[model samples]
Target: MRSANPARHVSLPFPRAPRYGPEDQAAVRDLLHAGRLSDTSRGPAIAALEDAFADLTNTVYALSFASGTASLHGALRGVGAHPDAGVVTSPLTWISAILVAFHAGSFPVFADVEPGGVNLNPATIATAGQASAVLVTHTFGIPARMDALTAVTGVPIVEDCSHAHGARYASRPVGSWGAAGCFSLMERKPVSGGEGGVLTTNSRTVYERALTLGHHPHRLAAELTDPALRPLTSTGLGYKTRMPTVAAAIASVQLRRLADRMAASETNFARLLDVLHAHAAPITTPLVAAGSTRGWYGTPLIITEPVPNPAALFAACTAAGVPVRPLYEDWLSSPLLQDPALLHEAFPHVRHTGWRPPDPHALPNYQVARRQTLLLKVPDVPAADYMHQVGDTLATVLTQAIR
Candidate 1:
């Protein structure tokens, strides 16, 4: 008894259905029975999740944290990003990536994104100047080019894998390429811990340093073997950043289902792309780079030809129940990085270290890409029939919008 109208007939779940299976419920239930409600440090559940995640990402070590920001903070400090040091990254990313640098009391720097893409341009890294650390964000689940980046900067790299869970680059996982890879387990991320984070690394020193920065003594005692860090183990550097036992319990379950979810998500996005190619034009498909796989934090459709009315196109799509929208409507990020007066006035670190901002036109590629792109929120569940309706709705709306 569905309505013939595409808008009324369409039934796609935005924000996704609660992704927990019975296994997830069981994880929490078992933890409660064991009386481990929340551990001040990485508990048995947290440690187990960390080990499993490290294995999944092909890394030697994984450390858990209370949130994604904490994990990034730990990583920056772990790799020696101090007040005198500088951390450089592209401006076209979540503000947390830049905020972490300031959190560590380090000067933040920016490099332009690649031409017509979200990832950083390797050639421009030199122009950004010598930074003590490089932090990379895999924007919208598309892996940053690690090989190109590695060739340019000798400084350590920390990846913010907030969007990318199963996404790979050059046949290698995104987290495995850097000195430390930070993943957010916040409810919306591919790996939902409800609220938690993980930092994966290969270096023993980095692991212990990151562990000591946020974890309590109990964890540090067992995990820290380095002589330099042993003295701090009494209080473990005094920050309680352990993943909640409950979150760990949830994440462990989500980790097991990640591959399956990604595969199903891929199928759903592919079907929509098929519809777009055949029935929609001017509203073009995403230009995925060669060899780079999308984690699909978002599925962006770039407008190939200028539409008569951009607002009309977005409104029509929404009216048809497609829920298409724009991103970075104001693409300029880090106003402080541009205005030296504000930059120096805001942070003492900037004044102490003479780090100048890049030219306004430094990020021309990201500028164009951000404006042209329209984001589609894909269904997290495998609702195949519903996907077809959603795709058809967009196709019909787009065709009408151009007319």
Candidate 2:
């Protein structure tokens, strides 16, 4: 039923973690010796990371958080999300993107992504009715149609730049196009610190609000300009989502090395795509919109033909040492939104309002994409020999499976 190739093997490991060099080790060692690991003690590492990130993204403010989810929640609160407001966002994203709305006491309205594209369609967003805010995700490092989306919607826009830290659309960085942009530094991300996140924004109000929500009460008061508001510092209105000093140190080093890593990833992606095209492989790669530069998180491939037994293909790929898997394979349904019991427990306000769950079947594009697409993990910098082997393995397995 299935073909297996035991001889062919990919030398590179799957999900390779970032290696710490002398600079990373020195930063951590310095932090440990200082015994001031907390940001409250004016930790130089965290402050330095914030400043570096702000400068890199060309944003006025960059606030670090414990995780990308925390940063998203903070960004939502910073943009004035209320219980009565609805946030229009793409459903084809990480569950955390949707959960942040619930954490902020805001309702999430699903918007369908464009055909053959991972980002939300501007037309779909426009027809989603009145929304207080719109969240755009540059899914898989491909820049969304920010210009058109912004022009169509008259509301606060937040860019989910977790997979698109260095990606650009029309020569402008993703984080600069919206009211605020959120990034992740988790282990799997292109640039990671093991675990951390950052929110960048040009708006001072948004920055101040996010800082107030993420930082400690005493620290928030010290940074506040309004004398009257300073009194409220005894009990800050926000949660504790501050980043650790050590993680910041790691992230700073990774940020500095992002350009080179991206270049290598881009080159490898081009090489693989070329191999696939040259051999007339039956897998389609993700399309990059004009003037948009992808960060190349992972190469997305769409099966061009229907396989009689999909599991056989997967088995073959796995046996051949190819890190091939279903796209968004972990999620079956949109959480909370799809589960009424969980939604009621998490957000009690929804029970009284009588909410209706979005029909997954209605999202034709998302459904088709999910079913047809597979993700291939490529190393940041792959060896030429490794690339050749990968190309041969993919072409062989896919061709066999299709027949």
Clashes of each: 0, 0
**Candidate 2, after superposition: displacement of residue 242 in Å?**
0.7
lDDT of 2: 0.78
Query: Candidate 2, which segments miss by more than 4 Å at Cα?
Result: 1-18, 226-231, 306-312, 329-335, 352-354
Q: After superposition, how far is residue 245 of candidate 2 from its true place, in Å?
A: 0.6
Candidate 2, 36: how far from true, in Å? 1.3
Top TM-score prediction, candidate number: 2
Local accuracy of candidate 1 as per-residue lDDT tens digits, 1-403: 2224434325655536567878889999998899988786666898798998899789999999999989999999888887665798877777788868877778667888776567777888887866889999987787888998988889999998998887888888888898999999998788888999999999888889988887878777877899998998788877788888899889988888888778778888887767566554456654455766678677667777646676677776777677665564332334766677876677766677746665656667766766566777776678677777776677666656665
lDDT scores in order: 0.78, 0.78
Q: Residue 239 lDDT in model 1?
A: 75
- Flag clash pairs in model 1: none
RMSD of each: 3.6, 3.4
Q: Estimate each model's TM-score.
A: 0.88, 0.91
